[model samples]
Target: MISLRNVTLRRGTKVLLDAASVTVNPGEKVGLVGRNGAGKSSLFALLAGNLHEDGGEFLLPPSWRLAQVAQDMPETEDSATDFVIAGDSRLMAAEAEVKAAEAAGDGERMAYAYTALHDAGAHDAQARAQALILGLGFKTTELNHPVNSFSGGWRMRLQLARALMCPSDLLLLDEPTNHLDLDALVWLESWLKRYEGTMIVISHDREFLDAVTNVTLHIDVGRLTRYGGNYSTFEETRAQQLELQQAAYDKQQEKIAHLTSFITRFKAKATKAKQAQSRVKALERMEKLAPVLASAEFTFEFKEPANLPNPMLVLGDVDCGYAPAEDAAAGAMPTVIVRKATHTVSAGQRIGILGANGQGKSTLVKTIARTLAPLSGIVTEGKGLSIGYFAQQELDVLRPQDNPLEHMVRLAKEALPEGESGREQDLRTYLGAFNFSGDMVKQAVGTMSGGEKARLVLAMLVWQRPNLLLLDEPTNHLDLATREALSVALNEFEGTVMLVSHDRALLRAVCDEFWLVSRGSLAPFDGDLDDYQQFLLDEAKRVREAIKESQKEARAAAAPVLAPAARKSSSNLKALQRDLGKLEQQMLELQTQKNAMEARLSTLSDPQEIGELGLKMQTIDESLADIEDRWLAISEEIEALSS
Candidate 1:
């Protein structure tokens, strides 16, 4: 359990938390949420013991093991797997004892050390570490690669994996999904559901909070409030509270007006002078109620496209990827990701691109945007085709040293007709619509936050009024309000849209269809998100089974010196097959239930009801995962024996 009673925390002159109190019970999963710069990170720092409260008591079990993602990027030569494994301090200690005992040649000591190692699960630690790394989107082949070989984003993912690897009684994760793709986010959600400990996560993703957290802890206006249930519940409850507060304020204002009016009208009359004085005294004694101050909300709409082009783009026998450098001294071939993709993107189509990381989703998007040329095919565009591309890496399109006004000016100069470039004042007004005003309009892009940069890009896109929008992870850096605004704008826009996003809310709101990019093929997926999830699960199973088969064949090829009993017996094979069949049947039932629950969840509006359904769905997912693990273990045993 953790307790913060009347906690007053400050950094220099700013008060992050003032007289804020919250008690988080053991085993409770809490979602810490607030607007950006509302002291969310400061509270996390306080919990991590990097800061101390200026007043009141902050207490937790002294012996509890706490795990948190490291903020610093590690530069080390250790393999990724080794770095993750090192997070388990207890396991490492146990292994060290085992090695020490063996060196000393003490039989009794060695037996005790081996028991400790087994109890620590040191024997399968590598396998568990590998699973964490894989779930975080690292390739299996990269598991043994040096940690420093990864890019900055991948290194941050490594830090997340290491934090998850540590065995903890309390875990704190801040913006863990910021660096993850849709597939990795899904995997992390499932993994967190299986964590049987107290967890506090700070994230801006509403759907993710609803999925993984049961309690909500909000920091606002230098105070803390705890709400039962998930983020949706908290939101509903807060809205109701605000409504009541507003009503009370209005009632108080009415009384004040009546009293003041009576005093003004009757004060001069001799008979009523005494009553007016009494009224004045009463008014002075009344407690004042402050009006509710709502957070600022902004909305902007995209301008209508100048022309609507039917069959906006056609990809015939398209191979999308990078072309080899013509100046290469050695033999080099073009790296193709999507092979011979033949498709037509029609006008007014709202298509969502779906794929795992490293798949061809981005490659195909780049090809359509004409940022990357097709390797060996024709990419024909309509006569009036115009494109607005929002790249995943924002800096790729934005100049870090340029201000918002400057970027908008550059965009107008390049995109407008020969003599129709908009005036500088109009461009400034347009930038103002995206919340860049006064000095902010002149602020350099390098000094702005991610959300600000995203807004600037969107401002530029909307100003050009392109007929087609190719957005890749547009919601990655957007806050909830901005994401909602973007969804509304996309829904209202008449342009064709091809979106690649991990934000489920935005996807559900804007996308009308989905295209799957996998295994070097691009094709339409005739199903919803639920079906896609099931497909991913089934594909994973098939891949694992294929790997097992390959291993079995390899063992058989080397079986000349093996004993005959090592081979599978008829009875053993029959029993294993029976067990597998039973597990599959159970899994099918769970999958059906899961899909049904998901469908119901989509139609649900009540926060409490949605929370309940989410929990049920999470339970079903955990059960399904457990059954899959069992099936894999049993199949592996059968394969080893049969080989």
Candidate 2:
């Protein structure tokens, strides 16, 4: 349990919380939300003991083990698996004790250390770490790679995996999904749903919040408010409260205005002098209500293109991938990622690109953006075609040392169409539309936050007046407000859009169709996001099955033929088989119950009831997963005995 009673938290001279109180019960998954700079992260810092409260009581279990992603870049040469395994400090300590005991030849101490290691599950620590890595979209081959070899975003994913691998009673995650793809995000949601610890996650992802959190803690204007249920419920409840508050404010203003008018008119008259004096007292004694102020809304639109082509871009039997580096001594062949991809993207089409990580979603987008030439086949462009591309890596297109004004000026000179002015003043005003104004326009792009850089990219894109937008993971670092603004703008835009993002909310709101870039091909997906989620699950299962089969074959190839006497007794094998069958039956029953609960969830109209059903289903699924693991272990024993 955690409690903050009338807590006042301040950083420098800015007071984030004044007399704010909140109580979080054990085992609750809380979504901490607020506008950027609203102290959500500050609260996390307080909980993590990195910051201290200015006043009042801040209570947290001193003995609680806390887990959080490291914000600093990981700089190490350790293998990824080893790095993740190090997260379990207890297990590492136990293993170290065992080694020390053995070195001292202390029999009793060695036994005690061995017991501790077993209790910490030291033997399975590597397997657990590997599982976390795989769920985060890492291939098996990458497990042995040095941690520092990964790019910054992949390093962040490694940090996330390491935090999740830790044994903690309290988990604090901030923007955990920023670097994750849809597949990894879905996997993470399922994992968090099964976590038994108290979790406080600060995220801008609405769908993720609704899926994993049971409570919402909103920080606003030096106040903290707790709401029951998920993000959607919180939003709905907050909307109602705001509406009532606005009505009350309006009514109170009218009353105050009428009393003021009455006092002004009758103060000089002897007949109404006493009443006027009373009215003035009433006005002085009345408590004023503050008006409900809505958060600022961000809105921007793409300028209409000079010409809208029927087929803005075409990839005809193309092979999209990275070309060999010019400096490569070998001058090797181009590494193809998406092959035989023939597709036509026309104006006014909204397409969401879907794929697992490393499956060429970005490659396809880059090919269309002309960042990479097709390895094979021709890329045909229509007459008067224009493209507005937003790269996932903002630094890829942005000149770090250049200010927003300079970037805009450069874009105007390089990408602006004929008849468009390339003047510095015009570009500066254009940057202001994206919220860069005053001295901010002169600030270096390298010094800006990711969200600001993303906005700058969008502003540059809009400045070009492209009829087609190719955005890859555009919402990665954006806040909820900025993401909403981008979604609304995309929804209202008349130009064609091709977006590759893990943000399902934005995808659902803006995309009318989806294209899958999987297995080295591009094709239209008939169904929507829900269908894609199911597809990812099925694909994961298939991959697991294939790995199992490959392992089985490898074991067969490695094993030497055994004598008949080497086999285990038939009765023992039969007993193990019987246990496996019972476990399988239990899992099947639980799965059926879970599926029924899911079906009911869809039809239930009440939010509370739906949340209850979802939790119930999650419990059943967890139990089924346990049973499935048991079944697998027993079956493996049975197979070993029979062999």
Candidate 3:
């Protein structure tokens, strides 16, 4: 258990928490949420022991193990699996003892060290590390790749995996899903749900919080409030609390008004003078219910486009991906992720882009946004078509050196028509609408926080008054309130929207249909996000099973050398015979199912249906594992008997 008793914390002159107290029970999964810059991270810092409270007392079990994701980007050349395995401090310590015992040539010491190492799971250390890596959305082949080979986003994922690999009683995670794709986010949610340790997570993702958290802790106005349920329940409970507060405030105000009016009118009248004085006394004695001051909400909507272009975009056999490097040798072909993708973006259509990480969801959106050119085929734009594109990386579309006003002025110069008025005051007013008022408009984009930068980008996007909006992970840095607001805005927009996001709530609220990118092709998804989650789980299982099967093949290839060691095990021949017979029957049934599914997969034209059936075949493959292992054992026994 952890407790913060009337704790006060400050950073420089700003007070983050004032007399805030909250108790977190053991094994509780708490979602710490607040608006951007509302001390959620500060509270995390307090819990992590990086900062001390200026006043009051904070307590935690002193012996409890703690783990948190490191913020610094890793620069080491170590293999990814090895790096994650290093996070298991107990295993590392046990291994160190084993080596020290070996160097000292002490048999008793070596025996104790070996026992400790086994207790710490030293044998399956690599398997555990690799499992965490794969669950965080890395390819099986990349498990042993150099850590520094991955990009910054992927490296952050590795850092998260390392943290999760640590054996901890208390875990703290801050914005862990900011870089994850939908598939990876879903995987993480499932993993976290099964975690038995106490977890305090700071995430802007509503669905994730709802799924993983059993408690909610909110920070507002230097106060901490504890709620008994998930994010959705907290929202509902808080709304009702606010309503009751508002009603009390209103009743108090009415009573105060009546008291003041009576005193003013009757104080001069002799007969009512005593009554007025008594009324004044009563007013002074009464307790006041203060008015509810709601937190400032940030919201903005896309301006209606000047013209609606039906069939805003038409792609004919377009291959979406990257082109070869300029310094490449002659005849270098482009890297095409999605082959022959043909689709139309019509007016008022809402389409959600779906895929696993690296499956080209972002590539498809980039091609449509014209940031990346298509490898081949035609992209036709209808007359009066206008596009408002939100790149996944804010810096991709923003000049970090410039401020919000400069960004808007540049957009006015390039996007606004010659005859149209593009006054600075109007731009300032518009920026204010997105909550970038006063000195903030002059603040350099590079110095602003991620959520603030996202707001600035949205402000500029709205100014363009584009009919077609192509948004890529727009909610990655947005808080829950802002995400809901964006959902509403998108719903009200009269133009078309093509969104690529891992925010399930936003997707459910705004998207009308989906397009899935997989295996070098694009197809219309026939089911909902729930089905997509199942597909991702199946995909991950297949990756794990494939790794296992490859290991089995490697072992079989080396079996000849192990023949001598495997002999003389014929004592269990009768038991081995019975096991092999039962395993053979199970294998026969699984093989029949596999053959049927493969045949069905061949005839299926619908992509979603094919994917579902293919996943079934993978399940059959898993069920047949026992038969293979038992058959090998029986063969070894028979050979040993003959020898």
Candidate 4:
């Protein structure tokens, strides 16, 4: 358990926290929410002991271990697996001590070594490490790959896995879901749900927070407020509180106005001078209400060119994935990672692509954007169509040395004709619309944060004002407020949009159709993400029933042999058979739990709930599959022994 008491944190001229207090209890999952510049990361640093607070103290149990995943991963030359394995230094040290004792052949020391190893769970550490690696989206082949080979996004995933693997009493995560795809996000959600230790997550992903957290900690205007529910519930309660505050302030203001009017009307009247003077005194003593700041206005307008055809983009028999080697056999068919994919986007369609990580969602987006060439499919462009592509790697296109304004100018030149009208004005207006104004526009792109770069990329895309927009993980680094603003802007935009993102809430808000890209195929859900979630639940149930039946058949096939063994060695064989029966019953219980979860999933319409349900279903399916496999193997062994 950890507590912050009267903590005050200052960053240069800004006061991030003033007399802020928060408590994280054992097994408590807290979601930290604030504006981008409100110093959520700074607070995490203070808690992690990476930074000292200007005032007050953070109290923790003397033996409590804490780990934080920083936003910026330090540059390292080690391999990804090596970096993660380093997290178990304590366990490794214990192992070394045990080895030393073994070499000496001291019975007492050897006994101590065994105890130490057992206490540290060293035997199972490798298994846990492997699971963490897989959960974080690293392939087995890539585990030993050098860290330098990965991009920033992949490096962030490595850091996340490292943080998660560290044995700690409390974990502090700063935007841990920023770089994860849907599959990784789902895995993380499930892991956190079953995690026994405490966790404090700082994230802008609404669905992620809702899925993993039970409490919400909100930092607004140097004040901290705790809500005892998920993000959506907290948001609703906060809205109600704000409305009540505004209403009270309005009533106070009306009373004050009436008193002032009375004083002004009667100040000169001799008979009423005393009352007027008393009213003036009361007015002077009254504390003025703090003016409520207006929410930032986010307005986006797309200057539509000529109308395009009904189908904005079309792919026929598309094979979307990374291109193969150029010097390969000339007549060989390109291996289709995503095969027989044919889809059409209309001029007014708002479509979202949904699938697990490494399932070719990004590949499809890139192919549609024309950033990558399809292996063998015909990609047809609609008549008079102009596409605006916002790739996940858009930040790479920015010049490190160029300032934001300079970058905008370069992009404008590339997008505009030679003598376009009001190009500079358009850039300024677009930048302002995205909340970059004054000196922020002059900051160097290299010095900007990930969120800032993402905003700039979005601004550039809006300036182009294409009729069809292709956005891939556009809200990756955006804060909650920014995401809401984006949702509003996208809802207002008249042009068509095709987006690939793991933020289910954003998808539900902005997309009218769901494009399920999975297992090298594409299926369209004409409704919203809610409909897609129901479909997934139904599919999971069908898979579960099929697996259950397969397991039953295997058990039936081995039953006759077990019966003969039971007659020969009644006691021992009956015990073993009872054990197997118990295991089978447990598996059935797990399957029943899975079906219940599926039913609950079907009834939910909230994206956050759906995401959580999807994760639970996946975890249940994996466990059920493992149990069935184990049972089948045991049945085979029993049959072989009987023979």
Candidate 5:
């Protein structure tokens, strides 16, 4: 659907893309992978026709329609659903025209309206729209809520849903999964798997790329290379290729050294002069292989303080939730969201918080960090409990007006020992470890992207050298490469870590125990996320089978009691029996629908999709209400006979 032929893009003096060519076939999912500032977003812009390339051509079929999830959406007074529905403006406009024509009572115009409506599938549009809304995860109530109330992260989801709703031949998604929770990510993966059109996604999520994409297109050093297969496969192949290149470069160097030595020794000898001259000519003509740059080394070494307590932080019978100070006079409680969960964090304990969205993960983190008070719970701090809390939304603490160097200098002054020499040098060294080196340290934090800000926060936290670290969604904005670096750092740290993250891969890599926050309760899992997921699935299956078996037995037990009444008073008995049968049928259908809805909900992974499913399940609840009403009437009738 889209192809780039010898494309070269330059931003000022920097060559972002140099003679890069790539072909994306229809219905293919391609992952665009590279380091930060490697021009992944720039490439997307070029293909999206939003940016003009300096050289070569970007080709697309004439009929191909392209849609991109815009980085920044225009401010509007619309609701989340309203924003999404706006994406179908063309269809809406056509419908409006049709309505106007119908109102005018013009036969010719009305006929045209009819044709347009039929062609556009106007009759089925409502159903499709509802399905899409539900699939993206918006509660029916939330669908009408104003978009202005949503955070920037939620706004991004709205944009993604709108992009998905558009009828396009090619979709270019940049960091599409950044704001998505685990459920939403999974749902998006499933949707992309079944997507009929082409997709070129720019993501730092390794698992997401591996699950959704069939091809990997890497951009590095103003060049592009395509590998056939998923992200893991691409990594393996890329590593092998790099190894081969290094070996070849090494062999060439050895040959050149040997030839240079021979030339130096035989320069004055008449017989060997000709051989020396030939070697010199060969050396001059040899194409020098580009030297490979080593990956940035990130080492996090913390000196453990003596006299540390067994429990770093403790919460006993604690209630944790967000409470607005302004609403305190309105008799607003702390929500008591996390109820009396006696939790302990000790040295060397790596805990991972696992749950659905809005389950009070962030609230719990705040309570442990002592940023918020827990209502009616004993929250005690252990001796020498030096805590470094990294809030999910706390990147705002970094002054945008200050450059990286200024921030680093301030942090160093505040965090370093009283008389430590080379403080500025230490700040430089710390920033360098986080990939901010030389001139980059001079860039304003205001101009930095979300990923960069996240890295900076981590770097700052490491510099503090706290014994207890409280991190919330640390991996949210991080790219794959940076996330790996963090994972390595976290694993090597000797201090205690309590983290709430949606990244399963990172959790598995770093966490030792799982803390599940579900239904206002915090339950500790002695295993990983994968194990917890498996346990949930197994429990759900058991519940389903139990419900089915109980229903079957109930029906069988009622059959014999109704058989004799049918023979004695035929008409009346038949009427009663029919009513009972209808009730049972209604109950069965409702139960079946509930099961199906639950199964569908289980299949959904995206937050939006889960939200949509919740809305759908709400609609199905009406059917459940009807079933319950009938079931109650039938139960009363059945009980009368037993009396």
Candidate 6:
């Protein structure tokens, strides 16, 4: 359990929390939420022991192990799998002990080290790390890729994977989904819900908070408030409280005003002087009720498109992928991810791109954005077409050395379409609409936070007055208010929209249709996100089966043939056969249990019930893994005897 009673927390001279109190029991999943500077991360810091309360009681058990994602970007040449495995500090420590024991030739210590290592899950450490890697959307072959080979966003994902790899009593995740795709995000939500430890996560994603957390902790105006339910329930409960508080405050104000008026009218008369004095004393002793003040919200909208083109663009047998390398040897082939894709995007059509990671969703978007030229096909554009593309890595397009003002100036020089303002003051005003004002406009872009940079890009996008908007993962850095604002803007925008986002709320709110990119093809998916999630799970199960089949084949091929006169081993083979059958039956039962739990999970709105289901599913997965291994061992024994 963790408790903060009458706690005062501060950063410099400013108080972030004043006598705040919160209590969390073991195994509770808490969603910590607030505005950008509302002390959510500060609270996380206190939990992580980097900060202490300025006053009052803060209690967390000393024996509880803590795990948190490292904020600093990792720089390492180690393979991704190795990097993730190292996050298991207990395993690392046990391995170190083994190494020292061996070096010193200490038999007793060596025996103890081996026992500790086994207890720390040394045999399955790699498998555990790889499972996390694959769940987070990494391909099997990429497990051996060096950490430094990935981009910054990918590196951050690795960092998240590392944090999840570690076993802990308490886990802290700050914006864990920022770099994740929908598939990865779903996997992570499932993992966190199944986690036996207490978790405190700071995320602006409402759906994520609703899915994983059972408790909501909101910070506002130097106050911390805890709610019993998830974010949605918290919002409902808070709205009712605000209404009640406002009514009470209004009633209190009326009484105070009436008393003051009577005192003013009668204080000079000898008959009423004593009564007025008593009224003044009563007023002085009364506790003033504070009025309900809503938190400040930021919102912006897209300007109406200059012109609406009915058919925004048409792709004819387009090969959406990278072209052949210019410096490659003669007759080199181009790598095509989405082959012979044909589609027509029309005016005011809100299209959502849906696919598992590495399914060429980004490749398709890049082709439309003109970041990558289509290979061997024509992309016919509408006569008055204009596009505002927000790439997954759009920030890379911004010049880090330049300020926001300079970036806008450069954009104006390159693409200041008619009727759009290109004046310096006009650009500054536009930036201000997105919360960049005064010194912020002139400040270096490199020095700003990710959310600020995202806002700057959005401001620039709106400035274009584009009739076609291409947004990929746009809500990654946006807070709830900004995400809602974007959803509203997209809903009202008089333009064609194509979005690829992990944020389910944004997807449901904005997209009227979904296009799926899978297995080197593109097609319309006649289903919602829920159906897609089930599809993903089914697909994953099939993949696992295929892998198991391939491994069985490999083991058979590698096994040494026994003597021709192996009739004596018939009884041994029969025993192995019985064991294999039992293992197979166990696996079938576990898988059945997993499937039923998953079905229940889809329909369950209660976080606690979902969490329970998740835990059951995890146990079933481990049991299946164990059964499969034993099943394979039995099969091998039979094969060796028969071959």
Task: Write out the backbone clash pairs for model 1.
Answer: none
Task: List runs of model 5 lying over 4 Å from the truth.
Answer: 103-109, 118-140, 245-308, 327-330, 416-422, 531-643
Q: Lowest summed lDDT over 10 consecutive residues: which window, candidate 6?
A: 285-294
Residue 625 local lDDT, model 4: 64
Candidate 2: Cα lDDT at 615 = 51
Per-residue lDDT of 1-643 in model 2, one digit per residue for the tens?
Answer: 8999999999999999999999999999999988778898899999999999999999999889999999999999999999999988889899899789768766556545655776898758999999999999998889999999999989999999999999999999999999999999999998999999999999989899999999999999999999999987887676557646666456446656756886899789875554465456545422221121234334466675787787887888999998888887695888899999998887767899999888999999999999998899999998888888888875566888989988877667676577675887777787787889899999998889887888888887887888889999998878876776576567546578899999898887777789998998899999999999999989888877887888766544433232121123334766666666677788778878877875775576764565455456546756765665555555555687778
TM-scores for every predicted model: 0.77, 0.80, 0.81, 0.74, 0.74, 0.81
Reference-based lDDT, each prediction:
0.81, 0.81, 0.81, 0.73, 0.70, 0.81
Tell me the spans in candidate 6 whose CA falls farther than 4 Å from its real position. Answer: 241-296, 417-421, 561-643
Model 4, range 1-643, lDDT digits (tens) per residue? 6788888888898999899888878888999987778788787877777788788878878787877675666588887777776677567777798789668755445545555665777656766776787777776678678888888888889888888778888888888888888767777887899888888999889888999999999887787778999887887666546546766456446546755886899789875554465455445422231112123223343455456566787888888876547887776556566877888777667788887667788888888888888887799988878788988888888887887777778877776688764466666766887777888878888889888888888777776768888889988878776676576456545568788988887786677677888778988856666566565555445644775678677765655454444334434545556656866997989989978975775576665555555556657767876666556655654665566
Candidate 3 per-residue lDDT over residues 180-293, each given as its tens digit: 998889989998988899999999788899999999999988999999999878876665566467664565466567568868997898755544654565455222211221
- Evaluated against the true structure, the overall lDDT of model 6 is 0.81
| lDDT, model 4, position 28 | 88
Q: What is the lDDT of residue 153 in candidate 3?
A: 92
TM-score of 6: 0.81
Which RMSD values do the candidates have, in order? 16.8, 15.8, 16.2, 15.5, 14.5, 15.4
Weakest 10 consecutive residues, lDDT, candidate 3? 285-294
| Count of clashing residue pairs in every prediction | 0, 0, 0, 0, 13, 0
Tens-digit per-residue lDDT, 503-551, candidate 1:
8767766777899999999999999887877776676667568767786
Question: Tens-digit lDDT track for model 5 on 1-643?
Answer: 5778899998779999999998888889999988778899888877777789899998879878777887785577786666776665456766787679657755445445544554665545555554455444454456667778777877778888888877778888998877776645655776788888889998878778888999999998999989999987887676546546666466446545755776798778874454355446444422231111123223233344443566787789888876667846777655677888798777667788876556678888888888888876798888888888899787888999888878878776676688653467777877887778988898989889888888788877776778887888887777766676566456545577788776766676667678888779998876766676565555445644775667656653554354434334333644656766776787688778778866776565665555555555546666766555545445544555545
Candidates 3 and 4 compared: the better one by TM-score is: 3
Q: Which parts of model 3 are misplaced by more than 4 Å?
A: 104-108, 244-296, 417-421, 564-643
Better of 1 and 2 by TM-score: 2
